[model samples]
Target: MTVRISAPSGPFRDAGIEALREGLTRRGLLGCGAGAAGAVLLGAAGDARSQDAVQPHALAEFFQGHQVAGAALSPSGERVAVLLNIGEGGARRMAVDLIEAADPSGPRRRVPVGDFDVETLAWANEQRVMMRLVIPVTAGGNTPTGRGIANRTYELQSRRVVSMDLETGETALMFGDERVRMRESLNLGHIVDYLPDDPDHVLMAAREFSGLMALHRVNVNTGRADLVERGSQLTLDWSTINGVPVMRRDISTRGSVINIFVRPDGEGRWRRAWRQPTAQVALADFIWIGAAERAGHALVAARIEDEDVLAVRELNLDTLEYGPPMASRAGLDVSASLVDARGRYMAAAFYAPRLEYDFVDSDLGAHHRAMNGFFGNECNVVLANADAAHNRFIIRASGPRDAGSWYLYDKAARHFEYLGARTLLDTRRLAPAEAVQVATRDGASIEAYVTAPPGGAPGPVIALVHGGPESRDVLGWDRQAQVLAAQGWWVVQPQFRGSGGYGLAFASQGWKRWGDRMQEDVEDALAQIIRDRGLDAARVGIMGTSYGGYAALMGAVRRPDLYKAAISICGLGDLGDALAYERRDDESADGFVYDYWTSRIGDPRTDGDAIAAASPRLRAAEIACPVLLVHGVDDPIVQVHQSRGMNDALQAAGKPVEYVEVPGAGHADWEDDVEKDLMERYVALFSRAFA
Candidate 1:
């Protein structure tokens, strides 16, 4: 059963930023704490309130309401650990609350986890929880060496993992040791499995001295680790089943190759199961949905030869073959699978317009359908966590307008009790995002999302390109788009050719076409939106972060007449400089970053002319409109130098440009104050350009 809510009426009421802040305070959205007070104080100090006194909503409100942070369910299903951002401004900090599952509104206890920011959390057992920490690192002239797993060239200062004993209120670092000299190192092994049978130990993938990742059996309580499986020299990634490492991947210039190894009877010599390329591996790929009761067989999500979408199937490990489909969707990819405590595939989820689930287990499906009916599907529902018995679980529902809420589902009583919302916001005021398709000049259909102001009438549009030209935009409550809409600007997010989530054919088209076809797709979206919605052609502007930022600058250089103004946040300027930096930082001569970039973005060493032509810094003189450059001083991914170089080049050309350098901000870490300031600057700059 699926329920859909009506699209919001006209844009939200044009209340001033002050009124928005006051409303948040009156509604207790901003807690009564020093951190909250600091945030308010910081906002008061800003000129945002003075710049646009009659503007509806404060930028701070949007930022505050959008952050629910993280949540996890206990193995016993008795308690839920929720991580929320409390306090405001620089004083704001992340706090974890242990709430009772039965009585969510009842008094809860705060877990003292210390100063570091918690990135993610999971249950080690009913009495223990594991947490990954995001520690701040100072920016200097330090160049990271070697490509880390996943072709990551820029390394964070520190990423540590630790375990907390809820019973004793004690926590210990999981990776700190005398043997390992953790200097500028990406420490804290990645958790593979909790090993439910052995609560004291968890399977982790830790980086060894050989620059290869090896599997280890880590003791959560003692921080002692024993090597379980050693990685080969070419091992790029690995997967395990029932706590046993069975598959390893080697990524090469050609493509990914998988090696499947099996151990019979849980002991003796490990023998080869099978080997295949990514295309063949996709045929019978094993998904780590759960620990199967049957040793050599597990639930898998795979794509058949003729199918465009993935299907849920039972995979035979011994023979590397797939059985009949358990659940298959026509056009949508199978997103995830739900397994019961007994290791049985109970449900499968797929996303068509929004997320929809099918029950493979009749009993569990019926119960979930009933729960959905009771909950009322105004928002998409997700099963966050469940206990072994499948009798109790945590359900999170969220939509494009709604921030989201958590609920506890009791299977025995067939009851769903309200927990708490991540934030309290007036949904009526938020604009609804509509999925759209635009035909490019080359006749390729590009998937895009457009969020218009209250009325259907078009106005000044902001071409908000998404970062990760590799990542695609989906339907959700986008805070940035909402904030822009509240200020009366239409936001168009285009999923250019190279973006993921559509299909291999669609994504593969983006490779090595960064500035050429990729930029064309973005421009085509803007032109199509103008024609379709009758938007003001002269008032269109382009802005983005990272790759999106790169696109913004490139658009201004390549098609200055199309965009009225441009903004680039942490964007790359020179392709040559970026590739050179990667080559210098990477210890491996033929590393993944060097090879991947060479294929996807063109090699600076060999394809120097093409790279130079696409570089925004080199073509700065061609930009005719005003440009806003914003970058974090401590950004590791695309260094601060990128923005500085572009700013210098523009200044040398006597072009209209403004630069803002955010202190102590990394690639992904933006302070509340910094974001608020940027929002205000955007409004001021764009308003002037449009006027």
Candidate 2:
């Protein structure tokens, strides 16, 4: 979630920074020896008290509290469009509306896309759009799960392609597919994209049985499709090759490789155009923006890297020559738009780490005030390069306390006004966040945040570890972390090595060391905060979900002295079990998965000793702290037995362990009500144990 970021002004900004240092030093002293004195010392340093305003609420109530969706812009930069829904349907009902960009807050004209479901929507021109609509189908009898409904499927016969006139509010059916190929409990109509140059043609790839992908080109005019290619594993990317539109397949290789395929030159045949190197680079790391206005087949690509800014490169197909990066360092997170025939204006967005609204302007300097909201850093922009100066864009905005909304930014008015329904969130109430930095065991700097209950003395701190050992913690509104702090405990989120959003080198460093220095990163974060006296060293707790959960379990077993309590949610108990069970149908994806774990954790067969040492279940006996284990029974990703078996071991050893099972939930999407219940239980349990 996005957290509204501002350079804390007035006396609060300086005061906050000072308080953090004092709190840290006091906590550090307590960790060394002094206990009560350290707590008091830290308490005396803070100016603002933790607020106790947020009351417990139901998750369903929270879902109903807000509207969420994306806003789209017209190519001419005159009109802004957005998708909105009225009621809460599992499959959201969509309606596109157009509003005047000059008077953004004014009324809008609504255009209904369809009733069944808006599978995909793409702009055909400034006044027209292509949409894929599908009818939902359900099986006759109940499967075995809990709900009485049959498996739902997206039958080809149940889908129709239609074109809508934005200016006239008229719709026309382009094509209809009536083939019923596969029979699964639920059919997913995977609508990937529409041909960039032609609205009558759409590109779609579906996962057939046995994990093979069926790539098809559907003609909107004829409703007929031809299978261009089929592969056991293929990821497609689209772009212009030699001025001709083409499709590129990400095929199996060392890492990820792209093979460009061009349609037969005037002969109605297909041939390979150019292939990217296989070892180090992946075509997905960069997306083609638009070709230069010049005559040659020069294409522009947005190159993705460790840094936030998007790199622009000029690609020549005939000579296969690539130009140096342009538009580099556009204030960290820089998004760009291609200019039109006149080259009058180009739209772009730029952002930095300090916390502020994303700037979306033709000159890249406008729209700061409109973008700045609570957790504004969470806002993302999608630009439509429809002939350059005339462009359409979508902004998805959300934060910890607020659901996200989409806005349409039209260059004509120099404003991005609000569009329709937005994604609902549960961030009505939240706690203040304290940004701080700590040192790793090796003295390398680590960034972290410490947040506590409002109006409360510096209390117990929970080492809120993040998953993705490859993911980094950015400044934003975090519901889970804020909720813990509201419960009177200090929340600490550490960005350890292998965390992205930092740089490529740092993220890749965690490649093969999951529990070693990676664990040290978490430990150092906790130790530094304790040394600073921001939290009670004697009553510290460590908790994480997914990868974070794994870290919590490992932390408890490896160093119980620093953490008195541990919470693990959907954590992996056995590394070997994960590698074996985590295989997808694609062997290449699976191989990379296996390589990542085994190289970092240990190979069960080759490095049996290391795997056993790293697996939490095998080391459960070493954990002396109280542990809370939560798992979802229906989790398709992480097996539930990972938690059950570990809990049993702890129980057998006479250790304090509580196991909570979510009956019909998955790994991350636990039913909304279940999330609230879990939060309440965690808060009460931590308060009782720590306080």
Q: Which pairs clash (backbone N, Cα, C closer than 3 Å) in model 1? A: 10-454, 11-454, 35-87, 35-88, 36-87, 36-88, 39-88, 39-89, 146-587
Please provide, for model 2 over 438-540, each residue's C-alpha lDDT reduced to its tens digit, 9 standing for 90 to 100: 8777767767866655554677888888765555455555667767765667788887776644545565566656768788887787788777856688888
Say which candidate scores most in lDDT: 1
TM-scores for every candidate against the unseen true structure: 0.71, 0.68
lDDT of 2 at 395: 47
In model 1, the Cα lDDT at residue 59 comes to 58
Candidate 2 TM-score to native: 0.68
Error of 2 at 133 (Å): 7.6
TM-score result, candidate 1? 0.71
Please give the range of 10 consecutive residues that has the lowest summed lDDT in model 2. Answer: 30-39
* Total backbone collisions for each predicted model: 9, 44
Shift in Å, residue 635, candidate 2: 6.0
What is each predicted model's overall lDDT from 0 to 1? Answer: 0.68, 0.56
